[model samples]
Target: MSIFKTKSFWLATGMTLACSVAGVLLAKLPYVNLIGALVLALLLGIAMQVFPQQVRQTAQPGMAFISNKFLRLGIILLGFRLNLVTLARAGVKTILVAIIGVAGTICLTYWLSKKFGAEDELATLTACGCGICGAAAVMGVSPQIETNDEERKRENEVLAVAVVCVMGTVFTLLEIGLKPVLGLSAPQFGIVAGGSLHEIAHAVAAGGAFGESSLDNALIMKLSRVLLLAPVALIIGYWYQRKFVRRSVAQHQPTPKKLPIPWFLAGFILTSVLGTFLPLSAVVLDSFVQAAYIFLGMAMAALGISVNFRVIFQRGGAVFGAATISSACLLTYMVMMAKWFF
Candidate 1:
């Protein structure tokens, strides 16, 4: 049956659209904007569980479409948000800081989360979210994980997103509040916020407190980390494949065949390259950017509906602690790097 002709598809799509609009509006309000539109949409998605059982049963296919198909599409569109030219303008020193910060945060967060008794999938997801672009990074790397249990996979994804949201918001506010005490110049402060924070939105909120130069440099610095997402995801995919192969051989089990690299991720990289080099008009670029936001909003909303709150409550404490420790360390590291490099 045609997806468009299915009543359930429209019902589910309509729910997502309604949630997206509400989330965007809520994000624009004072104080609430700190939570951001994506997070707001996620919260609304979680609330979808309260609807009638018949509605949920019928909506399953459409919801799955948004979660899987829209998610990849959103990630590809997200590449348009990155401009190699702007990232280059941020200077070599700032770029190096971003690179080191991402690497360090990932290693530290993953190791610590594992030590705290997190499963491999949970630890890796949280680490990626912290090291790169929060929920987007988590979602991007998720498909690479070699998990037989689909429920467990979705649970970890939700937990990782929640951890990053909480951690990112905490650091965002701290950066804003510490601006007076730090006494750093605008660009330096921007570097610290962009290099340290989890999400682009977090960096914007924190860096924009300083001024225009701060906001611009902060975005470029954030994009430096964003640009690394493609490479990091590829590395994770390769790592997982090798690890799974080794496990299969040890157990004398047949190795499962999977793509060495996710096709969607390759598309992401290609889109980024084209967006960077193409002579696209401002209007066209802006439209693409808007589309990206809507797609991402819907994707996040779909993921939110799949969240297992029971699992989160059961395993959250240790993982949250791991994320908190990693965030604190990354923030300090960025501060030192910013002071030295700037």
Candidate 2:
């Protein structure tokens, strides 16, 4: 049967549209704007999972469509938002801050998760999600790592909530307490905020709350970390081969196919380059960005539909704990680096 004719497809599509719209409306509200549409979508998706089994069954295909298809498209379009000139204005120091901050978070989370004996796949997925761009990174990295389909689905469901909630918590605490607690100047805090936050939206919200100068610098720095996705994904692909593929080959088992560097990364680079040359109108760019965010929210909702709360609650605390600790360390690292180097 054609996917278009399936009830499941339509159900998922409706849910996607509904959740995305709801997320946007929520983001427009006072104070809630900082949490952004992505968080709202994640929450909305999780809430939907509480409905009767038939509803979720009917929505499965459409939710998968949103999670998989919509996700890749949004990641690619995000490239159009990157500008080399903006990155340049933020300076090399801002670039370093992005790189080191991301690296530190990933490394720290991985080590901590391993020490705690979490599953390897779960640890890596959580690390990438928190260290890079939240659910997008988790989804992108999922294919490259060694895992069964069942594990991937669970990771998607669990990480969707775990990662976003951590980011929101971090963003909140920073906004509420960082400046006064750390006694950092505005420009300094901008670098720290840009470098430390996991999601671009969180960073943008934190910086934008400050002022224009801090927002500009923070966003540019955040984009620099976004660009690192290509290299990091590539390295992860290679590492997956060494760790999983080699072992399977030696054992004469079915080996995993080498996942290529995601095509979306190429699109991102191309768009960023093109953006530096033939930039679109600010209004047009903003529209595209908003569209990307809404699509991502829809994808999160789709992913969330599959989550088993029983499974999530049983296994989520360790991963979120590692991420929270990593976030704290990253914030400290970013502040010290920004003060010392910049």
Query: What is the Å distance of residue 45 in model 1 from its true position?
Result: 0.2
Question: Which of the numbered candidates is closest to the native, going by highest lDDT?
Answer: 1
User: How well does model 2 score by local distance difference test?
Assistant: 0.74
154: Cα error in model 2, Å: 3.0
C-alpha-based local distance difference test score of model 1: 0.85
Off by over 4 Å in 1: 2-4
Worst 10 residues of 2 by lDDT: 151-160
Per-residue lDDT of model 2, residues 37-95, tens digit only:
77688778878877899899878877776777787777777777888887887677777
